[model samples]
Target: MTTTTTFDELPSLVGTDLGYTEYVTVTQDRVNLFAEAANDGQWIHTDPERAASGPFGGAIAHGFLTLSLTIPFWTELLEVEGVTAKVNYGLDKVRFINPVRVGSRIRMTATIASVEEVKGGLQINVDQTVEIEGQERPALISRGIHRFYA
Candidate 1:
């Protein structure tokens, strides 16, 4: 995990990799729940039997479902102090590089990319990647922007 107190703290983080969280296994039940909540019930994500014969050979998690896990990953990576409000501003570039198969154990690696002063407090840019255990490629890569207000 990495902790930063000011914009200057960001520079120290360049090339530094944060630790991973305990592996969280992706399950069909969780995928189904996400699909139901997000209203994205695509066969590849919700149907196991059908997906077994489909591409990738089995049901895979939805890209957004995997993307949404970034919050939990971030929580484990850093601690924010002296902030009255913290909001997700947006994402810069996001890509689903690899499919997250059901039952796969996944964790995230976070790197502080940059930080700048904003209206309320500061805006931080973080480069985050979600990797599936034992996989050569990451399941997701994204630049996430967040705003912190005092």
Candidate 2:
């Protein structure tokens, strides 16, 4: 985990890797809830029996579900003090390089790519990659942007 004493200390983080988070298991219940909420109940994601006979050999998490995990992953990797508000600005580039299977353990690696002064605060760009244990490639690779204010 990476900790910052204050908001101003964020800018000094440029080009530094913020470190990784502990593995979190991808659960069926979580995937099901995400499917229901996103209205994306694809059989490959929600149907265990059917998916068991299909390509991946079993049910897999929705791509969006993996994307959504970024929130908690980032939170676990970064801690800032003296910040009144933090907003998710957007993502620059996102790629789903691998399918996340249920029961898989995944964690995030965060790197501070850049930091710049914005209207009300600092706009920070983080390069994030979600990797599955023992996997050569990451399940998700993205550039996330966030703004922080005092």
Q: Which digits, one per residue and each the tens of the lDDT, describe model 2 over residues 56-107?
A: 9999999889988999888987887888899999998999999999889999
Note the residue pairs that clash in candidate 2.
Answer: none
- TM-score per candidate, in order? 0.91, 0.96
Evaluated at residue 44, the lDDT of candidate 2 is 91
* lDDT (Cα atoms) of all candidates against the true structure: 0.86, 0.90
Q: Model 2 lDDT vs. the true structure?
A: 0.90
Encode model 1's per-residue lDDT on 5-124: one tens digit a residue: 544364355555667766799999999999999999999999999999999899999999999999888888876677788888899799999999999999998887887888868787
